[model samples]
Target: MGQSEATVGRWSEATIWLHWLGALLILSALMVGWSAEHLAARDDQPLLFEIHFSIGLLALAVMLARIACRFFQARPDRSQVPPLARFAASTVHLLLYLATFGVLLSGLINFLFLGPVRVFGFVTVPQLFDPEADEWLRALSWYAHVYGWWALTALVLLHAAAAFFHHFVRRDRTLRDFLPGRR
Candidate 1:
């Protein structure tokens, strides 16, 4: 949900903004997807799916930018953090990135296999993969998309819990390091 490191200075404003934007887009897609799940028998479900798909694509773009930023950015010194905690934080950060892309890619591939799904009932999604010929791959992507969502959800919760723990239990500024202008 936030940076894995506790910084001695503030993060770049762009990274901070992207972090919040990515969180909003991801959560919005999750809500829309959940609604579509519950409304499975309804006529408007496809509309929900279309909205979810659109948001997801946006999320993917934001995530890609964030990952690019990561490579060029220097992380805060972890000297103050316990080695185990630092390792765990880094692992969670990596998993969060992987799960995010995994979910998005699998969802996109699954739709391509199931297309031509209409976006907003006007624009038709092209069937890139022949569903009849790639039924097995379609099934695999479907499972990945569904299970990836669950995995991402769990990682988000863990990320948030770590932040809250730093704020409350540890009485540290680690959580504040994630806030904008909190240098």
Candidate 2:
């Protein structure tokens, strides 16, 4: 039998936690990365870069867990949403995921090209390619990483706006569905 549509629903606790954790990590990483890029070349530049990289890696891990939870858990019922809204939400979500993974992977690739990096001050990640020889690959990844962040930032803003619209304008429980304590 088909499940009944919920007038109000909630995601699993794990999903809620992972969603917020991923958002926090992504925001922190982006800020750190932007700061590291714009600062004057200083002795501490490597440390700042490593911190950004660490945050990006952690965000990637949380995102993976969130994806797994999404697959295994029951999502909040969307029966009340208009078809167009559903389509737009799904499209934005898909693009957000793509941009996030792209940014994280491209950043890793760009970093690897620069040679070994002492991640978090202890672990040494050996360089995967010669920076001088594979400058083109590095450049490509660099561009992708930077542009991916911009795309992600836009998508995130759009996502939040949609949620607020559903909550305040539409006067629905859409926003509460993802809140930590909602049921």
Candidate 3:
């Protein structure tokens, strides 16, 4: 009954929606962050920065809600997966959460120290620290934010690859667990 019960349940609707929403937000944030860094012209940079920052903040909120949902929701049982694979999957998921949170937090901290950012010309996000006085902190946060993005990108790739492996090679419901429908 234990094994049967574990295998029978599907992810909750809330979990599925959160999973897809978080993925979309994170991917969008990564692309916007990259564009702001390398593609935007000097004059257009502020707009791009505003979009990127806003998206990061949104991602942070989604991630926090996702974490909370994980605790309250009934996660689909993983007894179907091999122990080693289960461990690996759990590790990847944990790292994904950590990397995302790290990137968002560092970005917010950097912006707070260096900003009075005007978002899309509509609103100004006030600074937490004076840019001139907290230059050192700003630099540290900038480094963390940049490196955290890289780490998050790597983790995302790995996570996607693992899902594909489970779907194509293992032929399992692991990928389906987070996907909408397919109950």
Candidate 4:
């Protein structure tokens, strides 16, 4: 059955955990990235960049796991939601995923072309592209990463607003479905 037609009541525990974890990781990555870009002093920037890059990589992994879980696990049915609301939710979710992957991929390309990235001084993320010839690619990737982050941030806010609407205004189980022990 389609998401809007199914009658399932709650999301699986794994899905809920993944959703919350991914949210935390993404938020952390965004904060660090913003700091690296706008707040950190030039001397302190490299450390912040490394932290941001590491967090993004971790978020990418979690997102991939979440996608796999979505296919394997049951999701809360949207049958209680209006068709238009369901469509809007799906669109927002799809856009969020696209923006997330865009940011990760572009960041990876930029890092690869710029130089090797050291993650928390433990593991070194090797350079995948030569900087000399791939400067243009790096620049393109930088722009994509920046723009994708903005899009992701906007989408996240919209998503949160929708969730709040469902919880407070609609007075439905929509938000509760993903909350801990809500079933």
| lDDT values for all models | 0.85, 0.85, 0.80, 0.84
Each prediction's TM-score against the native? 0.88, 0.89, 0.89, 0.91
lDDT for each residue of candidate 1 in 1-183, tens digit (9 for 90 to 100):
444544435456677778989999999999999989885668988788998888888898998898766656655666777899999999999999899999999998998876777774477888899878988999999999999999999999999999999999998877787776665
Order the candidate numbers by lDDT, best to worst: 2, 1, 4, 3
Candidate 4 per-residue lDDT over residues 55-146, each given as its tens digit? 88888898888887777666666676689978988999999889988998898788877566698678877777887787789789989999
Model 2: pairs clashing at backbone N, Cα or C within 3 Å: none
* Cand. 3 Cα-lDDT: 0.80
lDDT of 3 by residue, 16-133 (tens): 7888898898899889889988988989877888888788778788888888777766667667668997898889988988888888888888888746787645778777788788
Please list the Cα RMSD from the true structure of every candidate, rounded to 1 decimal place: 3.7, 3.4, 3.9, 2.7
The alpha-carbon deviation from the true structure for residue 4 of candidate 2, after best TM-score superposition, in angstroms, is 16
Indicate whether candidate 1 or candidate 4 has the larger lDDT.
Answer: 1
Candidate 3 regions exceeding 4 Å error are 1-8
